[model samples]
Target: MNRSALTARGTPRRRMSVEQRREQIMDAARDLAVTEGFHAATLERIAQACGITKTLIYQQFGNLSGLLLAMVEREFARAAAGFTAARQRPPQPGQSGFAAGVAGVLEAVDAAPATWRMILLPSQGGPPELYERLDEARRLTREALVADLLAADPALASLTNPDHEAAIALLHAMSEELVRLRLSDPAAFTVERLLAQAEWLAKAMFGRRG
Candidate 1:
C-alpha cells in the first residue's frame, strides 16, 4: 500500500501544507478547549485530537500557552473585525448607528456560532491566560460599540466620563448575557428575539424612539 494508506496503528496520516497543518492543529485545540475546558486541552490531548505528534504541534504553536494565545487572537480578530466594519458603516435611515453595530455583531455570531461561543461563553475552569485575553477583547469591543453610539448621536456628548463608563459597563454586561443565552438556549433566545430586546434597550438608553 502507498504511504497514505500504510499506517500500522490507526487512520493513515495525510501530508498537509503548512497552513493546512496549522489550521488543523488550531481547530483541534479549540474544540478540545471549548468542550472540555482549557486545562483539559493539554499538548498531548491536542496532538492526539489532531492525529499528530506533540512535537509537530509545538513546531506550529511553540507551546501550550502559545497555542492558547493563537486561538484567542484568531477568534478575537474575527469578532473585532466584524464590529469594526459595522461601526464604520454609514447609518441606515431611522436606524441608530448603535443598533446597526449591534446587528452586525449578532450577524457575526449567527454566522460563526462557535467562534463567538468560544470567546463569550468560555468553559468553566478555563485557563487564566485565556480569560485575561477574552476579558480584554470584550472590553475593547464594548468601548468600540459605545464610541459608535456616541458618534451617531452627538446629543449625548455632555455625559461625563464616569457616566459613559457606567453606561458602557451596563451595555457590556447585557450583551454578554444575551450572547450566553443565545448560545445556550437558541430556541428561546433566537437572534431576532435578542435583537428585539437589544433594540428596546438601546432606545431606552439613547432616547431614540422613531
Candidate 2:
C-alpha cells in the first residue's frame, strides 16, 4: 500500500473531509452558542471541542465571524431539513398529515432547541453574513413548504395567487412564538407538551381533517 493509503488506515479514520471538518467545528460552535449564547463561542473553544487546532479552523474559516456565519447557515439548514423529515415520517395507515407534520416540527425543534433559538432570534454579536445566510435559508424553507402545500392541495392552485410569502411569514411567526414559549419557561419546552401544542396548532392552521 502507498504511504498515504497506509497513513489513512493506520490511525482511526477521520469521518469528515476538510470541508466537513469545518462543518464539525461549526456544529460544536452551534452547540456552544445554544448553550452559552453566541458571544461565548470562541475559536479556541471550538477547536478544543472538535479536538483540532485553531490553525485548522483559521484555514477553513477566516476568523470568528466567518465561523459564526458558517454555524448560523448550517444550523438553519439542519433545522429545516430535520423538521421537513420529521413532518414526512410515514403514518400508521390513517394518521393525519397535519398532525404528522406538526409532530415532525416539534420533533425537529426538540432535536436542536439551542440551534433553533439562535436562528429564530439572532441576538447581539451575530455576524452580518450570518443574517444574509439565514435570510437565504429562510427563503429556501419557505419554498419547501410552498411545494409541500401545492402538492397536497392541487385544487388550491386554481386560486392563481396563493400567498406563499404570507404563508412563510406565518410559519416563521409560529416558529418564533414557540421559541418565545421556550424562553419563557424552560420546563414548558418539554418534547411531549410542545409537540402536542404544535399538533393542535398545525391542525387548526391547515384545516386538516381528523
Candidate 3:
C-alpha cells in the first residue's frame, strides 16, 4: 500500500496538477460571475467556492484582474471555437446559407448558454477591461459577418453605395437580442422560433434582390 498517498486521517488525498487546480478556480469564478455578478467573484469568494486557499489562487493567476481576464478569455475562446465549428457544417437541404448560419449560431448558444450570457449580456459592475475585450470581440465578429454577407449575396456587394456597416450593425443588434432572450428565458424563446424568424427575414431580403 502507498502510505504516502494517504493523509494522516487515512483518507486518500486527491492530488490535482497545477492546470487542474487552475481550472477549478476558474470554474468557481465563472459560476460566481454568472449567478451573482463580477463584483461577487472576488478572490475570497472564489477561493471559498472552490474550497481552496486564496494564496493559491493568487499564485496561479497573479491577481484578481489577471484571474478575471484569463477566465473571460478562456470562455470567449471556447464560445468562438464552438461557433466556428458550427459554421463549418454543411447546410441542410433547401436551406439558405444565411439561415443555416443563423441556425449554427443558435446551436452554439444552446450548447453553452452561460458562456454566451457572460459575453452577450455581461452583468454590470464588471471591470472596464472585461467590457473592452467584449467590444473588441464584437467588432471582429461584425466585420466577419459583413464579409460573409457580401460574399453570399452578389446584389449586396454590387450596390453603388452599399450601407453594409449600417445593415450589419442592425443585424448584429437583432441577433444579440435574440440570443439574450433565449438565454434569459429558454422556454419562452426556443431556438426553433428564433431561427424561423431569422430565416423569414433572410428570405425577404434575398427575394427583394431578385
TM-score, candidate number 2: 0.63
Top TM-score: which candidate number? 3
TM-score of each: 0.82, 0.63, 0.87
Candidate 1, residue 113: how far the Cα is off, in Å: 1.8
Can you write out model 3's per-residue Cα lDDT over 44-136, one digit (the tens) per residue? 999998878899998999999999889998898988887687567566887766667778888898888778888888898876877898889
Highest lDDT against the true fold, candidate: 3
Cα-based lDDT for every prediction: 0.76, 0.68, 0.80
Off by over 4 Å in 3: 1-11, 157-162
Q: What's the lDDT for residue 53 in model 3?
A: 88
Query: In model 1, where is the ten-residue run with the lowest total lDDT?
Result: 157-166
Query: How many clashing residue pairs, candidate 3?
Result: 0
| Model 2: CA > 4 A from native | 1-24, 44-53, 90-96, 154-172, 179-186, 202-210
Judged by lDDT against the true structure, how good is candidate 1? 0.76
Which 10 residues in a row give candidate 3 its minimum summed lDDT?
A: 201-210
Per-residue error for 30 in candidate 2, Å, reads: 2.4
In model 2, state the lDDT of residue 158.
47
Ranking the candidates on lDDT from highest down gives 3, 1, 2
lDDT of 2 at 88: 70
Angstrom error of the Cα, residue 182, model 3: value is 1.2
